[model samples]
Target: MVVHSKFQSDTVLSYSGSIPYTCYEIGHTWEPGCVKTFFQTFCDAFKFSIRVYTVFYLATFVIKLRKKENRRIKKIKKLLRDILQSSIFLSANGAFFMGGFCMLRNLIGKFYGWHGLLAGFITGILSIQLERKSRRGMLALYLMNLAAETLFNMAVARNLIKPIPYGEVIIFSIASAGFMSLFRQRNGLPENLHSPLTLIVGPEESRDFYRNGGNFSQRWRLISCLPYLQKLLQRLKTVHRSHQSCPHNNSCTYYTLEGIFKQFLLGYGIQILLNALQSLRGKQKWSKVFNNISLASFLAGFIGLFRACNCSLRWLLDRDIPALHGALSGAVAGTTLYFYRSTSIALYFFFKLMEVLYFRGIREGYVPHLPSADQYLYASTLAIILHASCCEPHNIRPGYWKFLCGVSGWKFPVMFRKLFDVFGTKATTLYPNFVPDLDPRYVKTTAVMELLKVHGKWRDPTNF
Candidate 1:
């Protein structure tokens, strides 16, 4: 009777198991439920975050080591501090932008993958408030972010790895890299424009010293005997001074225009040379190359004209609303790049103007002062989060990316340097004959340095 009961129970159990069980064991089951999926995703995200942070920390450490030779303790402390700051900034930016992008994608329906472009544009604009960097520098950083993201996307498309949250990766990379770059010391002077005079004498003194200098020769020698070039420069200077004395001489229309013309000519010549090389490489017709050269030259000239006009307008309205002046100048510059639909240029300048005003307010104590570190952390976190959570990515056409890529090759750097000069950063000395790697410190003769010392002493009688 007991054996008969056991057989019956086993038969009943087998009968139940033959059908799929509601919550547990069944004939077959494969789906991971919501909770399990969520946990898995969370684990993946955490791993990704750690890997990214490690890479960033290592890169930053290497850069800092190369830049400074501090003692071991101090170096380690600095590295730790920077890492902490970078991690915080990146985490905040990533969390915020990711939410924002997801929301935008839902609302705008993807926009043909142009959402990335919009995110990048916003990133560039917002970066200005956090770091005192040139617009070109900010743009370059953003492009780097985009390129990295694109490469990752390509890898995913090729099934190199399982699908992962790339948006998070991009935002983190950009924030970390941008923050890291804030600490990088600018070369301050371009290699092409390096000169003994520039190294010894400051920018203002060098400009004054070279005011009567002649045009650059074929060999880039600063020859003073070029009668026609000297006459033309004198006339331009005269016209520039005809207007009210600009508060900032660097912004003077005449000087700005002259600088623009010089830079344009140099850039145009270089473009022609590069085109020749390209033609040889591709075995293209000379006529086609010549046509391209003409087009490039025309574009270069247009950009130079627009920049000169912007500088002039800023100088003319120096006394009035400075912010408005900046906006107008930016608008004018943007108009010139209208062919490329570069409205971002205007937006960039507007933000730059606002940033300047904010700084001024802080200095004058009109604005409440916050601790620098706290301010950076808080602002960066807030801006990125806000952007990510609330905003949708505005799609930019793919053609625009191609156009930008074409323009960004070699000429972009030269163009950016000219813009830097316009802002009076003196990033490149105007000296035509300077060679790279000629350090002033190694020279045995202290004649020039001694003269400068005496001149400085003369200017400041208190020192005597």
Candidate 2:
């Protein structure tokens, strides 16, 4: 009869009850050691890259198809070319980083949690070189956002830092304010810098920024209050109803309600679609449509509150300072983040704001232009993510973790944690959730690595 205990790899104390040899590291029995792991990872990355690129590029192609300006055949060709480029960059990036980890381990005969950082850094610098230069900056910015959040979460987990109250709200507020100012002059900027506010507030209305009605007549302030009231009422009733300083061509009440309804529907539709996706994944009941209603409410409330605040400010000052209006209204609208409390969205926008500002500085000659900065930042951020994911999985963002798992062929869980335990990362605590790649109960025979749903027989992990 076969004897079993928890798949402990740290010690070799038993024969039948001993930890499997493959458990000593990540590679499965059929693919023992570092060299085999590299080849295995290469295959996984290649297959996953095609699937990921198809999904992304297919959606883009469908969107571009709506615009008749581009020839259909040309668009299809572009799509195929982009997908090819993407696959090469992504496959190489994923394969090298993952295989790099094992490669690094082999050099020293053992690996620690921090070794993932070195592997990631080397792989990132090398892999990014294969990517299109035009795409590097955006990729760097996106990775920077994830890295910042990961770093902060890790710090909090270690009690090295405390969570800030309403921090995301504050960050979103500042970034949104800056974005609004930029959006006002978007005509001079990249075509892709569109904001949802343009759709909700009306393009014409948003474009009329910095409009200032001259101060009210002193005579009206002293007397003829009735005429002044009449003038105000007349302005509200007119087709282009708005304070002289206001931009919209509608009564404040109409504009406010219109924005509210449209924005609400926009947000609601998005949330519903997300819920539908979740339902497909069997994560939640589809009937519970209102379960995450606040996510929609956050967007709807933001539009309403922002317009109300901007109108009030204009009415109070009897004029409009476009800068003040944008800043204050954005700040007020930012409070809506409290409805959903999404740390991820806020953190992303914070990095995005910094990126935009830095770019602006470069254009204005205030910031130095650094070539390859994007790749460097990308490498640095990837290292942080690699180190954190390996050493402190608990701190990684759930979506990011899931994405990493998919890209890595679910190998994150199968990583041999016994060596990492030396770093005092509390890795053993996470060990129970993941089976070692070489567990006797579930030996892998083929190159395709999948975690089977059924647990054949798990021996209660015994302490060595």
Q: What TM-score, computed on C-alpha atoms, does each candidate reach?
A: 0.33, 0.79
Give candidate 1's error at residue 114 in angstroms.
23
RMSD of 1: 26.6
Top-TM-score structure, candidate number: 2
Candidate 2 lDDT by residue in tens digits, 370-393: 988999999999888877666667
Whole-structure CA lDDT of model 1:
0.36
Model 2 TM-score relative to the real fold: 0.79
Which ranges in model 1 have alpha carbons more than 4 Å from their true place? 1-39, 46-244, 247-254, 261-330, 337-464
| Model 2 alpha-carbon miss at residue 166, Å | 3.0
* lDDT by residue for model 1 (1-464), tens: 11122111223221112111111011001111323422333343344444556687778677767655753788788666655544433333333333333344445642222343354334434433433233334433343334433444434544676654333433333322222122111332233322432322123212122332333222223422577766665565556453342332432455555444554565567666777887889866666654544434434444454345444654566543333432343334333333322323323333333443455577779997654433343344333322212111111224433332222121111211111122122323332222122123322223322322433411332433
